[model samples]
Target chain A: MLELVTTDRGSDAGNSETAVTFERLLDLISRGDREAFSELYDRTAPRVLGLVKRVLVDHAQSEEVAQEVFLEIWRTASRFESQRGSAMSWILTMSHRRAVDRVRSSQSGHDRDERIGLRDIEPDYDEVSETVEIRIEHERVKRAMAQLTALQREAISLAYYGGYSHSEIAGILSIPVGTVKTRLRDGMIRLRDELGVTS
Target chain B: MNDRHDDDDPRLSTGAYSLDAVSPDEAEAFERATDASESLREETDGLVETAGLLGLAITPVTPSERMKAELMAKLATTAQLPRQEPVAAVPDASAEPESAAPAAPTPVETPAPDARTASTAPRAESRARSRWFARPATLVAGIAAAAALFVGGGVVGTAVSGGFGTSSVTDASAAGLAEITAAEDSQRSTVPVEGGGTATLVWSNTLGRSAIVVDGLTPLPDGKVYEAWYIDAEGAAPAGTFTASGEGTSWHVLAGAMNPGDAIGVTVEPAGGSTTPTTDPIIVGQTA
Candidate 1:
């Protein structure tokens, strides 16, 4: 079931070359190297745009936010700290935050609630053009996600992919806010453990 | 699984925060709480990294070709922030102090307005009039300083000379520096030292951690060192002490958790270090 909307991006865990290249590119970008910024944008734009589109589901707005994300990356390249996390994580985390912010700020409660009402149906993943590397990661994440209980999976999906707040998720799932928080937390911890993510 | 009422458990919110599932206010509160607890912050970072992996689960989408063209064109006008050394290298006598300091103080230097602001300025005048638009350069400098704080994780190099063991103190302070800078509510202030250098203080009120980076100050003579202090209404408390290297740059993680409204000050003291500051502060950066 998870495979329906699952496909991986080019870089994933254990790919040290991509990580090093990102860090190196950021280092150069910080020094005003336009070529490095261009390269960095080319490498990460698809994932950035993909993640934004997943949360927003609006093509034009998704593109706008993706552009803003790239501009932010360009302006704040010096802020990338290798010690805290990977360059890719930093970029994607920023992208996700921006997308969520847009969703929360732009949409009214009624509109968001209406969207949440229809959240159970999964979005189709484009499988025709994906690479083998992407499929491997998709399967790995799908397997890990499969381990989550239905409630946990539902809570995580609404919060992450749907950009819904816990209270809104509570409203959608008809559970108490506290219960929603617990489910989200437990679900993430389980996912982290299953994926073998280490701090 | 039991439906645990874990709203009060701050740790639970780490997941929501990582997923950007909480409201901005909740995220702020979580960040404040996480700032105070290193373990919580570490848990949050781990979860955030895990959530980032979830981003890769979707199929890739190629943006319109014009997007890249527009971005490339925009890049021609945008000014990239200056690079900062993670750890201040051995002071070079030939290097200009002004050049060594990350981000100059002038607000006029950061030309090229942000693309979003530029695009929306005419239509959304109210929205475009944010603090960022008013003083873009200052905002730029603050961001640069914050970024410097992150890369400056090892700014604790001088702590070794201050009598703390080299490896352990440096490692602990580096981690602390990273935590404070990464905190959502972290604040930074830069003040010019009396002697010619500048001291940039980065602190998080919730985390109670602060560090100062001093640049361009004249290297102190033998038996004299710079002492840091946390000053509030009642009195001053000694933070730590360290001498400037030959190049006149020093980074020290102030000792102990900071109290609310405490201001960070640095004064020169004797080599062994003083229990109390013996002279006037050469520089004071308010963290309140």
Candidate 2:
């Protein structure tokens, strides 16, 4: 089968650091805080929207999942503890999971041509030299991803973006369950080290 | 199969974890540990970075402003729905108790245009519409399928064995499949490709139609969708368009007999159906 690529519209100009702060507004949101929610939505929605577009690849599904992600944040603000992760992470995670669900729900496994690997897909490396405000931050994240081993890289990606669980990843890769575990363990440590995320 | 990773949230590896590779006990164990520890959460963050990587792979396209508007309209309707309570008629402000609370007048222009939406708003309670989720239809505004036929059921680069891999094949080729007149009665004529899934095309002369059923296929990404193609000896031509009907499976039928070719193959193309297939055939067969 030939490669079928689905292009997106925006870049992650917003750095992970600022994007990470979207959670502050969640508190206000639970209290039905209006201004905070607006601020939160402005900073986070673009990336969330982008994330949805990357996965579901359908405009309608992207929009639908976006709305649901926001609404979910509105309704479940209390469950969001900053200790869990960044606000951007929470929101983007919501968008990804929901998009995956919709994608999974719609297709019944006949065709599997969409092999959109992150490294294999985008055109940013050449454009990395381009002047963008978020370039430094974006590069930092990319560099962090590079530090991990290939197994760590592939394992984390499949589990995270592929939306497959441990068992699923194991089945796809044909690796033993133990290898999946340690790789994921080491992958997270490497990611945290990359993010400079120290508790 | 009841291993530590299976019983714990061992960050989703691609291979062994692609499907129900584990036993019930193993999956249950994994779920329990996933819930009990922060392993899943940490891995979740890494997943975002991975998602970021996936985002990078997408060729960027400028979105239309109209798409944004359409979505905003959709949000306004959905937003107003939860808060709306059906009423017999559009009511006036006369029935409210005036107090320390600000004077609530009957809204001249209801936020949502739908009748059901207007009726659903807080009856006489009339809370200010300034709530973040409750923006004026203006800010509340936003905006957000096709089947075409082409040659070969595109399924190139699909996740055949890699745990965390993706394919460039569009799901569209599944739609344009011409009915195979010969295989109508076979209960299991469809076959699975070495690529980790199965696909089948059914033909029915009475209905003058053909339909393709794909199972175990991987799901697609957003914005970029897949289109189906019908193959003819002349070359690949647009047959129709199809979105994922559900699961890792899609069922799409041709409008008429796909007599365009002596052989049929599947490939991945752009969102709109391609003039010809650019990918390899995920599955193929000749029409009887």
Candidate 3:
């Protein structure tokens, strides 16, 4: 059983569709697939680690959590159902849980305050240059996001990457909570329009 | 407003933002809206993907090459490895213990402790045959009086084959022979510094080397050692100590070899021989 999400025919004009194949590989891995799992690890580890690095902010802890999340994926892949979400969403969600857990485990707020005063540990982009799949995904999203102004991207990244709740984002931006809500919603609409998504 | 009256509600946008869907927030409003909107569940997913992309932007500290090896080793050790059968278990492969047998050279040292075989007959013969071993003269003197019956022979002190001078018992073949014959009990073959023999310990003045042939004596107690004393023929001062063994019929000169005028007498003492005799004389032999 597959849950298919319809992308705008016009918007996804150039994705090579490896995402579908990736999902298939994930399915095989769910069946105790060794080689498939290895392939999956090869393809996804960088991205998973990259994501975990953002929230956890510690390279060592991030990588460690990434491994744990992957192992968890291997163990619980059987429970994944197509109806709930895409394979990509499921894997990212798993990474989120592990990253958040790592964040909580580190008790790094004081230490974070002491270091550079940077709320979110900015990633080392020069480290893992974008892969083909990530590049494609990035291209699709950027095109959709192009509809929104640069201010919108900043707003979204701060909220998402910074883990700032809406109220906190409002306070950080020195704006009203209502204004933060408007900017976020409008930003999403512009993204949908730029991407030409049916929804 | 929909069932969710607030767009900037954290519940709505937080998950989506955490997911990295909107990619980034341009304004506080959009950021909060994304967090508030449950409809953008998948969009919030981008927060993490964005996290990944952002993570890539952070510097990487390269762990040493050995660190990776150490990691692999740890992985192998703690892999919760499935149990393989003993035959299949080769250690250094994942976590299985190495099943290979240890090397082969351990069984040969078990038999010969004294560097001599147990079956040797010299160590197994009658008490009188011990005289061939050579022993101390004092032991011979004691045995000359006491061991005449023990030898199963009609001859009494003649058992000592010492080349002694001007003694009533003047058998050249048997002067120290009583000492030699007396120590033969232990001299079963591997004679302990051969005791109860006829010949005295002949001393070398320069080297202090004394070699006495003794026979016919009892085996010395283990841990209880025998000390050889080099007494001047006048029988007063001690030269040094020789290790005495209560083993078989044999001549093992202790340290401080005898000079021409010195006599070799063995006294029982502690394990490593004492500086001087603390116990009574077990055997005293005059050497040739």
- TM-score leader: 1
Second chain TM-score for model 2: 0.33
Ranking the candidates on lDDT from highest down gives: 1, 2, 3
lDDT of 1 at A137: 60
Tens digit of lDDT per residue, candidate 3, span B1-288? 122356535544543344333222333455456456666544544333333332323222332222222222121112222223346754654533221111111222122221232243233222222231243334445444433323333433322232223234233222232222222121111222332433223333444454443433443434444456666524434443333222322344444444543444555555566665564454444432
Q: Per-residue lDDT tens digits of candidate 3, residues A1-199?
A: 0211332111233664544355676666555444455555655566577666666566666666676666565545555555444565567667755565444345653354355354343222234433443444455555555566776766665554554445656667787666666666566555544544332
Model 3 regions lying over 4 Å from their true place: A1-20, A83-85, A109-146, A176-182, A196-199, B1-288
lDDT of 1 at B176: 61
Evaluation by DockQ, superior candidate among 1 and 3: 1
- For model 2, the stretches where C-alpha displacement exceeds 4 angstroms are A1-21, A34-36, A108-131, B1-288
Model 2's TM-score against the true structure: 0.43
Ranked by TM-score, the better of candidates 2 and 3 is: 2
Scored by lDDT, the top model is 1
Instruction: Estimate, for each residue in A116-146, the C-alpha lDDT of model 2 and write its tens digit.
Output: 5434322243454333533544565568768
- Predicted candidate 2, C-alpha RMSD: 21.6
Give candidate 1's TM-score.
0.54
